[model samples]
Target: MTAKPTLAVVGATGAVGAVLLQILSQRADIWGEIRLIASPRSAGRKLAVRGAEVEVTALSEDAFAGVDVALFEVPDEVAAAWAPVAVARGAVVVDNSAAFRLDPDVPLVVPEVNAHTVRTRPRGIVANPHCTTLTMIVALGALHAEFGLRELVVSSYQAVSGAGRAGVAALRAQLSLVAGTELGTGPGDVRRAVGDDTGPFPEPVALNVVPWAGSLREDGWSSEEMTVRDETRKILGLPRLPVAVTCVRVPVVTTHSLTVHARFQGEVSVDGAREILATAPGVVLCDDPAAGEFPTPADVVGTDPTWVGRVRRALDDPAALELFVCGDNLRKGAALNTAQIAELIAAEPA
Candidate 1:
């Protein structure tokens, strides 16, 4: 029998990192030993896994030694600095940040929609796209293949957790303020009452939605917005595919949801699109308006698959379809997807 593969998780004490470890525990059959790596600040931190405290070690080139798969959830700078070293030390790196998603040699993958790209990682670094894009593509990729997606217009309602633990805190704090918990107001009011809290964001994240995420780059588009356009095009291999996206931060704790409208080259009836989505892998059909069964972040948190609901056809556009999708940003959007990629890569012949 083949020995189980060794795995290392970078940023193992972080929000996504924590979930990644939990996922590995839940999917324990695929792994042998688990190594948790983090920055020096987290080196002494002990993360409890399966009722055992695993000491977090400082991530370095040596951390990758003898590891078969390294899943990174650190900041872009750390992943950018250390992933190559990890690869040099012989580990297949499945990165969860935006660091290499658009890199020419690295493949941007969402396993359900673009698992083939995960296998094309010649440099041993496969990038997980932004959570919003991952959830959108899994739902849209099915329809794109069947009806020929011509154009896509997407708006995202991203959970605070996507920004990491701090983002979640800000939202909770805001809701606390909103509930008049401590200061007779909600969490957003607290931030506003004391200037602003910049833990997860530069500005207050309570009761308000921020249109911007990531740093502002040249041409006035923030990195998050550009990722939606660039990464989606690269993964789809359609640089000219007309796609427009607006990513926003919402008060939801987990599960990044999307409202997508796609115009297909060929006419696709609402029933036809529904049929396709119902049978797609990694996709759960929740589109029942009459029964009030629609996908929502509250309903999809902790779930494995992307959920789609509220399917409708535009009265004026015969070739267009509209739908809402909810996917656990931490699971399918990050950790679980990366883990699935590691499992798939292991299946390939060396």
Candidate 2:
């Protein structure tokens, strides 16, 4: 039997944070005492865990004093500021932010692929891949192992939830407006007017798709696009991995889906990728286009694994593989991944 480990969940009131708390409660065998920490605004809020409620406390420098593992589900700035502090105090930090994903010392881990990186805690801080990279790697990692992946051309149909809790609210608000007046904004939902409609993005996300996911980088690529490209290399340990990513925000509220076309170094049959995805950890295969059975965001919400379906061999190109994948952005995409990292680290003393 594995020894239970003391856990501290930072940002316990956020969207992904709440899911982390729930997943932890569901897996009691992997946890000991659990501490829920959030911002001062959310401090003292009560959240249920294992059928009982726990108080959410404001995270401080001393929050990690006696913790064995700390799962960070907050924004990058919060993780950047507190992750090192927690590590210094003694806890291993599993961060679900983009802050340290590209840090040379930090191992951006996807448990299904390079979980060994989590075991070797050289930096005391480990990164969970971006929600997009998280699902893409699960579907592709098996193929990368069976036949080395050389290039990836990915176009993501990401759910609003991928942007965090705010993204969810934005979608619902816009949907209500569109449903009422065919994309007419009401006076009441002011947030939908200013920021979402060409404010945060160049155009409104109501009943439409936004080509950008994150803020612009100096290189013209959005931050979300860069994350998908960089984090894939980190998890797959393939530096110089050719990846072209276009991230778009869809109207859905929970699951994020990706259409990936990968060119491999060696020959890979579609049947081979199918067989590998069937048994791969953290992946659920659903490729049956003829029978109308394929993974969909509607079916993937609340599920823990990345659902891969719509598998096909590329037309006019044998080495190129095309597939569709969807995973709950709030679950497997963010919170569950963080909790799983903490669970894995807890199994062995950090």
Q: Would you list the C-alpha lDDT of every candidate in the order shown? A: 0.83, 0.82
Error of 2 at 187 (Å): 20
Residue 152 CA displacement from its true place in model 2, Å: 0.5
For model 2, how does the per-residue alpha-carbon lDDT over 168-212 read when each residue is reduced to its tens digit? 776776666557453344543434543545434455677677799
- In the order shown, the candidates' Cα RMSDs to the true structure are 2.6, 3.1
Q: Could you tally the backbone clashes for each prediction?
A: 8, 0
Worst 10 residues of 1 by lDDT: 180-189
**lDDT at position 47, candidate 1:** 86
